[model samples]
Target: MSSLVFDRALYRRRLGRALAAGYPDFLLARCAGDLEERLSAVLRRFGLAADLGSALPLAAPALRGKAEAVLRLAENPDAGGGSAADLIGDLEALPFAAASLDLAASLLSLHAVNDLPGALVQIRRSLRPDGLFIGCLLAGQSLTELRQVLLSAEVEATGGASPRVAPFADLRDLGSLLQRAGFALPVVDSESVTVRYGDLFALLRDLRAMGWANALLERSRKPLRRSVLLRAAELYAERFSDPDGRLRATFEIVWLSGWAPHESQQKPLRPGSAKARLADALGVPEIGTGEKPGGEKTGGEGER
Candidate 1:
């Protein structure tokens, strides 16, 4: 996988260009707001925390007074303005000491990591026992319409299509990753944001500005042809436009929270150790599988 590593150098360059261009803030603003909302629900006080991969400068302010102090850690130092990020580090190779941080927060950045499982393991190791980790990432279903349109346009215009969008992790994959990384009480949830655009160009601009364009390792090196680009725009408008002729773009943000293993944290019950049956809790009569409620055999009229 190292041989096919993501072009982080190119990714940084695009992000830098986007920041200099004064690109749109619609997505980043929304992500920051979502992160703030999640941060508000965390009642426990943290002695020290790290905000990793923050696309904006909102993490510190959102976590102010919530944590004793927060040190910003970002992959792109220039992506944020006036941020006190003490370290510029990569997700796959976190620079923090093991078991040093009380909490860690990542804002819409983990999805781009080439070694997601390895990154999660690094995060797990960085936290102290029972330390909390909460983050959000763009899910696999995000921007489905744009991806479909772009592929169709390329295939029709050039007789073949290339990978134009990086693959994102789904909910199941994310939950399993946390567990595999040894996090306890892992929680995964998703929130979908639908934004209307004046046209395809508007959506593209937002993506570029957010520093989230096609950076796939297997992506085509050849520049997109003008004909294929125009076709994609037309298809996007034709297929995904609302009644007002604006394009609909979906951004499914998956939020995940987990805690490092600790003896004090809650643990699941062992198999077959429950004191009460599920049926009893629901106030329903217990019946074995293939048996009726009245203890009769199956294939009866009441079965269906």
Candidate 2:
């Protein structure tokens, strides 16, 4: 029962290529800055912070001010991180000991994880009590324009289509994952950023440089037809172009923040423990479950 969604080894190779290509930093920079701001808002100093699977030095540098020590973990040994990485490790399988870190942050990663919930559980287990975890990844709606055009174009050109992009998690599903992974006070949000490109080819170049190419285990091994690509570009320019003629490519960044559970963290009230009745807040009569409009119980007589 292999539940893997991505080819980890292939993705690592791609990540290595991205580093060699001088990976674009705009999205990483944005996410890293946001991670720092969110961590800063906590006001508590962290003794140790780890940047998990970010594949770069972005989060580590930003975390230095808030933590006494920061660990930069890279996905590939030859990722050219040089002094940037303290260790090379896998995000799916963290190498840290239990309760070792006071904070952990990942930027623009996690979307490629084969078992995201399991990875999150490991992240929680590695954190000290009340330790914070902040991360951002591409949401399901990321690259909507590219996804649509590619699928439509492929179908039109070849009479069928295969996955050309990886499937990303939804915001609500991510929030639920946090809770299921034993994270306390989980918070998830999404911000959509639309980037303009001269055309689909320009966008494809950026995606390749980002190491965000299709890594799904279920992806087709066959090369995309040149005709399909040409059709996709044409459709992209036709459907997604602005008045100025630049094509729009949306990237929805989903931010997830949570803390390791501790006694001090707020807890949900137990069922049937509310001190006030619903009627009191709504200024209306409260009807019992399965009761009639005249206050009659479904299996009993009406109250006098």
lDDT for 43 in candidate 2 is 76
Per-model TM-score on C-alpha atoms: 0.92, 0.89
The 10 consecutive residues of candidate 1 with the worst lDDT sum are 76-85
TM-score for predicted model 2 compared with the true structure: 0.89
lDDT for position 182 in model 2: 92
lDDT of 1 at 245: 93
Q: After superposition, how far is residue 185 of candidate 2 from its true place, in Å?
A: 0.8
Model 2 segments beyond 4 Å from truth?
A: 80-82, 271-304
- Candidate 2 accuracy as lDDT: 0.88
In model 2, what lDDT does residue 177 have? 98
Clashes of each: 0, 0
